[model samples]
Target: MDIRLDDLTHPAIHALLEEHMAGMRALSPPECVFALDLDKLRHPSISFWSAWDGDTLTGCGALRELDAGHGEIKSMRTPNALRRRGAGKAILQHIIGVARARGYQRLSLETGAPAGFAAAHALYLGAGFVETGPFGDYQEDPFSRFYTLAL
Candidate 1:
């Protein structure tokens, strides 16, 4: 698989993001949902990527710069067809590499804390992220679980 910077408008990427947002909405209450809309991910501080296998988009992920030494992971999603096929791992490794290259010392992410998100929580933990308190604009919320890793 190849991972590269991408415009969020890429149809495949957009579809994957939409699915992820839908999952978030379904799994959490409206007020507790914090999925970034496309507009938010398009901000200057965010860098998005799409992972592909030849002509097929396998997954996507993004890193949002929080400061000179910190970043946040966002919009990480693997296509349904590509789930459990190493797509998510590839995208995550790419995100970590990019964050390191960008001089970020730490990376934080917010994900659902419910049973529905167990796989995601496990994935993050296996990737070296540890449970953490809120970062950035986030506050304590029963609907969310936060994780952080030192890059």
Candidate 2:
């Protein structure tokens, strides 16, 4: 799969993001769902990327600047039809590499804390992220699990 920075203008991206939002809402309560929409992902502080296998969109992820030395992982999703093809891990590794390239000291993320999110948890931990308390503006919540990797 080829992964590249996306401008979020493609029709496939819009559809994928919409699917991501719907999946998040289905897994977590509305109040606990924090997936960013297209407009939000377009913010200057966030860098979004999409993975494509030829003409097919497989997955996407983003890195958001929390500060000069810190970044947060956001919106990691693999379409239902294209999962287990290594796109998610590739996107995640790309984010981590970019964070290091930007001189970030840490990278963190928030994900759900249920069986449904086991794959995500495994992906993160397998990439060397350790469970931690909330970072950034997040708060302690039973529905959420936080992880951080010290660079």
Could you say which candidate leads in lDDT? 2
Worst 10 residues of 1 by lDDT: 7-16
Candidates in order, TM-scores: namely 0.96, 0.98
Q: Which segments of model 2 are wrong by more than 4 Å?
A: none
| Candidate lDDT values, in order | 0.90, 0.95
Clashing pairs in 2: none
Model 2 Cα shift for residue 137 (angstroms): 0.7
Q: What's every prediction's RMSD, in angstroms?
A: 1.0, 0.6
Tens-place lDDT per residue, model 2, 18-136, is 99999888889999988899999999999999999999999999999999999999999999888899999999999999999999999999999878899999999999999999998
Q: What's the C-alpha lDDT at position 74 in model 1?
A: 90
